[model samples]
Target: VVGAVVSITGVSSTVTSFGTTVRSDLVLQNENHMFLDISLWSDIARNLNGQELAVLGRSGPVMLAVCSLRVTGATKGGYSLTSTPGTRCVLNPVSEMAHLVQS
Candidate 1:
């Protein structure tokens, strides 16, 4: 897994799997131009305000922008979070698995 200290840009936007328009989370680059997109499978993210975090990635990480999260006061299993940049993101790891999990 690739580990890096990235600034938590914010929680992700709501995306419909339908149609041709693709959607994902947004994280700003450490230097210049554009955002990096990352896919979050669970309701495991939220918005951050210019907070930097140490993160270890999982699966096939994206190259466009960063992360996402389920919103506060949002209904269960519902995606209604607005794009909140500079939001902080938290990363967690499961304790059950062993070295069997790797990139």
Candidate 2:
């Protein structure tokens, strides 16, 4: 799903999914405010800020296109993984993804 990263805490990264936009508790933060102690993807053991990413879930149709992520220090509730800086990934809508692929 295509959306923006509203907030990033020690545990979870909140994304606002596009279309119909059903608000899920999975949303740690949004265009508005931040929520603490939310669960996050195990693979996301690092901080992502001002970066866009296409996260492929291990299972289910839950794919997150995240951007504007800010990494905070480790918290007791946060995922237990090392945080390393990396190049940001850009997330585009399906149409945009297809266009880029075709180009």
Model 1 per-residue lDDT at 44: 32
Task: List the pairs of residues colliding in candidate 2.
Answer: 49-69, 52-89
Candidates' RMSD to native: 14.9, 14.4
What is the per-residue lDDT of model 1 for residues 1-103, given as tens digits with 9 covering 90 to 100? 1223244566455465554224434443322222334444223333322242324333323221233333322345744344344334323323333232331
Q: Provide the overall lDDT of each model, using Cα atoms, as 2-decimal numbers.
A: 0.35, 0.32
Q: Give me the overall lDDT of model 2.
A: 0.32
- Residue-level lDDT of model 2, residues 1-103, one tens digit each, is 2223344333233434463322221324333232322233323423432222223321222333322333333446854222223323222234435443232
Q: Model 1, stretches more than 4 Å misplaced?
A: 10-12, 16-36, 46-98
TM-score of 2: 0.23
